[model samples]
Target: MATRQKIALVTGANRGLGLEIARQLGKRQMTVLLGARNAAAGEAAAAGLVAEGIDASAILLDITDGASVSTAVQTVTEKFGYLDILVNNAGILPKLTEEGSPSQASPQLLLDYLQTNFLAQVSVTQVFLPLLKHSTAGRIVNMSSSIGSVTIASEPLHQNGPKPPRLPYAASKAALNMFTVLLAKELRPEGIKVNSADPGLTQTDAGGPNAPYTVEQGARPAVWLACLDDDGPTGCFFTHVDEHVVNNPW
Candidate 1:
């Protein structure tokens, strides 16, 4: 008998850091599922991975859409009996159209950010949890950012400089991090591991060329969290810096 290959689903994997994360997981021999809103782009990403000799495919998924997400869960359930890893990588970083800090940001704008970044992630996790439970060991990696750190937000100079104007984005990530901690605790009895990964400023489409590091470096933390073995740390937030795992304070 042959061992079954683990399966991993990375949301918003059509491009940028999401795509790189899927590629890296595919390289590990896991059947990587690239989830994207655009079917053509998703398929293209999966095709590129296949060209790299990886077992990969694309699934139509829109984290913000209830129907799309439900369909994706059903699709996974039918195509793969169980899911070993889930990388919630879909999110937005909206820039300030008007001038202001968090207090100045409109309620609607903040709500929009929370809907996609925090609520949708939690909803997706809940929907796919049954599939995750089917695996002997399950891992959940919520892509977060250091800017989400409440402690860091309080700093006069975050990351050694003024914080970006995206307050809603930061708040959403903070909520996601909270979900990681609580979900890990809830799933501990079932041996499911949940953790948050912050891929610091990196050179991705979102990070831009001016960013210091590469997408490869940014994906490192999430990949590490996804491939964690039994007895690995859970309910924690970490960032990969200098190729070392550094715990981030909540």
Candidate 2:
């Protein structure tokens, strides 16, 4: 029997780091399902990848919408039979006013962050998990930030540390880290690896121009996690550019 190609679903893959991650994974011979909220944009992204000889297709996946998520799950199931990799990369950065403080952050802002960054990830994982379970070695990579690291955030010397407060985004990622740990344990028996990847401060649309790293550099960690063999560690925080370095303060 011929072996089936692995299928990877990357959320918010129409642009920036998410797009790069999809591209790199596609290059590694995985059939990539590029998830985007905008139908036109998603199709364009998949077309771009196909133009480069990558086996890719667009899936209209608005992570915040339950119907859209369900549709995406069904579409992938019908097409791919199983999903081997899932990258939860969709997230929103809350705009803050002049030197905002966590204490002064609005309740609504926090709720919005939780809904998109944390809750949506949980929902997506729950929905796709059955298909992932079907794979012999499933991998779930959560796109997280070093800012979410309570240890790093608490430290005064670190760049993503707590000198400036990005309360909502940071808290949501910290919660995601917890999810990674919990889910990794829950799925370990089935040979599924769940981990959080800190792509670092890459100069993507999300990171702004001042950020030092490129999209390619930032995309590596998640891709690395996604392609890991059976011996690869799960339920840990790690960076791509950094060698064998597991991120701390998670």
Candidate 3:
């Protein structure tokens, strides 16, 4: 029998790090599903990849919405028999009152963060598991952050520690890490690899235009994790700072 072609779905791929990941995956000759909440943006991003001679198409997916998630799953099922890769890259940093600091942030603010970052991830994974299980080498890559590091957050002398803790965002990522560990353990028997990717501090709209790393540099690790072989490590944290090394657990 001929080897099955891979299909990858990347959320929030209309722009930023997600967009770069989709493009890189396409360069590997896989069919890429550029998922976005907005129809126009998703179409545009998919078109851009198509122009690069990639097999890419837009799938309207709002990870926070169950209806949208179901629709996306159905769409992919009808078009592609299975999904080889899933990148949960959609997230947000709430701008409500007392947003960044844990001390003053309201409970509602924290809930908002969990909804977009953590809860949505769980929902998306559960819905996609059946399709992922059908693949010979299934991979799930969760986009995490260094700010989520409990160790770094505890160090007062550390640059990130002195700054106001982006409490909700950081905590949500920590929860995501735990999810990566638990999910990997459960899926190991099935030969599926589940891991988290910390893109470091990249310059996306949320990270500010002046932030140090470009989107391309920050996206490399997630792309790497998504394409990991069967022998690759699962349920660990990694960053894009070094290509030679991987799974430097947080």
Candidate 4:
């Protein structure tokens, strides 16, 4: 019998780094599920990839919505039977003030960030873990940010540099890093590799126009982590350009 193709699910894949990551995986002959909140956007992205001769499909997924998450899981399970890789790329950065300060960041804003960036990621992982377990080589990649690094946040050099105005975004990523470590520890014995990746300051809708890198550059590290071998490192935080594990304070 012919071996089955790997299946990957990428959340927030309608555009930016997540879309690039899905494209890369599809190029490698993986069946990629492009998950986006907007059905039209998701379909357009998947169709674009298909036009480029990639095996890709779109799924409606709003990470903040439990119903959406469950439905996505069901759809994937029914279609693919198992999930080999999961890229948790959906996240939100709270609006920043003109002065680049998060002082005016409200409780609701922070909660919204946490819900999508941290809590929803956890929920999605839990929902897909069983399918991941069935794969011979399972991988989980969480899209974290360098700002999430407690080490970076506490460093004098970074502190003296441009401090981020939005504290909630940074805190949400930190929580994501914590989840990565905890989940890695829990799943390591099962031969599953889980890691967090920082895509760097890429020019995306969320990363802003002035951001230096492109979406492709930002997605590289995530693709790398999601395709790790069985012996690859787990519970590690990495950036795409450097491909070095970050010394986070998690």
All candidates: TM-score: 0.96, 0.95, 0.95, 0.93
Better of 2 and 4 by TM-score: 2
Could you give candidate 2's per-residue lDDT for residues 1-250 as a string of tens digits? 9988899999999999889999999999999999999999999999999999999999999999999999999998898789999999989865555326878877888888899999999999999999999998999999999878998776768645545688888999999999999999999999999999988888887688998888888988899999999999999998854455355558
The candidate that wins on lDDT is 1
Residue ranges of candidate 2 with Cα displaced over 4 Å: 96-99, 158-162, 242-246
Clashing pairs in 3: none
Local accuracy of candidate 1 as per-residue lDDT tens digits, 1-250: 8877899999999998999999999999899999999999999999999999999999999999999999999999999889999999998866546425766878888899899999999999999999999988899999999878998777767645755466788889999999999999999999999999999998877787998879999999999999999989999998976978788877
Provide the lDDT at 192 for model 1: 97
Query: What is candidate 3's CA lDDT for residue 46?
Result: 98
Q: How much lDDT does each candidate structure score?
A: 0.91, 0.90, 0.89, 0.88
- Give per-residue CA lDDT, model 3, range 1-250, as digits (tens): 9888999999999999999999999999999999999999999999999999999999999999999999999998888879999999988854444564667766887898889999999999999999999999999999998778787666766554446667888889989989999999999999999999988778888777887888888898899999999899898888865554355546
- Residue 129 error, candidate 3, Å: 0.4
Q: Per-residue lDDT for 108 in model 1?
A: 86
Tell me, by TM-score, which candidate is best.
1
User: How do the residues 64-125 of candidate 4 rate in per-residue lDDT, one tens digit apiece?
Assistant: 89999999999988887899999999887655562235676677777877888999999999
- Quote the RMSD, in angstroms, for model 2: 1.9
Worst 10 residues of 3 by lDDT: 240-249
